[model samples]
Target: DASAMDKKQKQFDKLINEWKQKCEDITVELEASQKESRHYSTELFKLKTQYEESHEQIEALRKENKNLAEEIKV
Candidate 1:
């Protein structure tokens, strides 16, 4: 009976260690994912700003083109 109890205790200790290792791995992965998310978010903000500037430029060009067309017609 004593030997059987010892074996059970060892098994429990091994399982606990495995669970602790798994928790550590998950924490590391979560940190890396958060870092990547921040990087992508910054990139997205930059691209959005660039797109807005390009849109404004395009609108101005269209207005200039229309004025030129009117002059040509005159």
Candidate 2:
């Protein structure tokens, strides 16, 4: 009976250690993913700003072209 109890205790300790290691691994992965998400968010904001500026410039050029065409006709 004593030997059986000892065996059971060792098995329980091994299982607990495995779970602890897994929890640590998961924590590391979560932190890395959060950092990557932040980087992507910053990149997206920069691209959106560039797109807006380009759109405004295009609209201004179109207006200028129309004015030039009208002057030519006159």
Candidate 3:
């Protein structure tokens, strides 16, 4: 009876250890994913800013070209 109990205890301990290792691995993956998400968010913000600036420049150029055309007609 004593040997059987010892064997069962060892099995339980092994299972606990395996679960702990899996939990640690999952935690590591989650951290890496979070970091990548932050990086992508930062890049997206920068691209949005650049797009807005380009749009403003294009509008300004169009207005300038219209003014020039009117001057030539006169």
Clashes (backbone N, CA, C under 3 Å), per candidate, total: 0, 0, 0
Q: List lDDT for all candidates, in order.
A: 1.00, 1.00, 1.00
Report the C-alpha lDDT of model 2 over 1-74, residue by residue, as the tens digit.
Answer: 99999999999999999999999999999999999999999999999999999999999999999999999999
Tell me the spans in candidate 3 whose CA falls farther than 4 Å from its real position.
none
| Model 1: residue 26 alpha-carbon error in angstroms | 1.0
Compared with the true structure, model 2 gives a TM-score of 0.88
Error of 3 at 65 (Å): 1.1
Ranking by TM-score: 3, 2, 1
- Local accuracy of candidate 3 as per-residue lDDT tens digits, 3-74: 999999999999999999999999999999999999999999999999999999999999999999999999
Distance from true position, residue 8, model 2, in Å? 1.4
Q: Candidate 2 has which clashing residue pairs, if any?
A: none
Off by over 4 Å in 1: none
Error of 1 at 36 (Å): 0.8
- Candidate 1's residue-wise lDDT over 9-65, tens digit each? 999999999999999999999999999999999999999999999999999999999
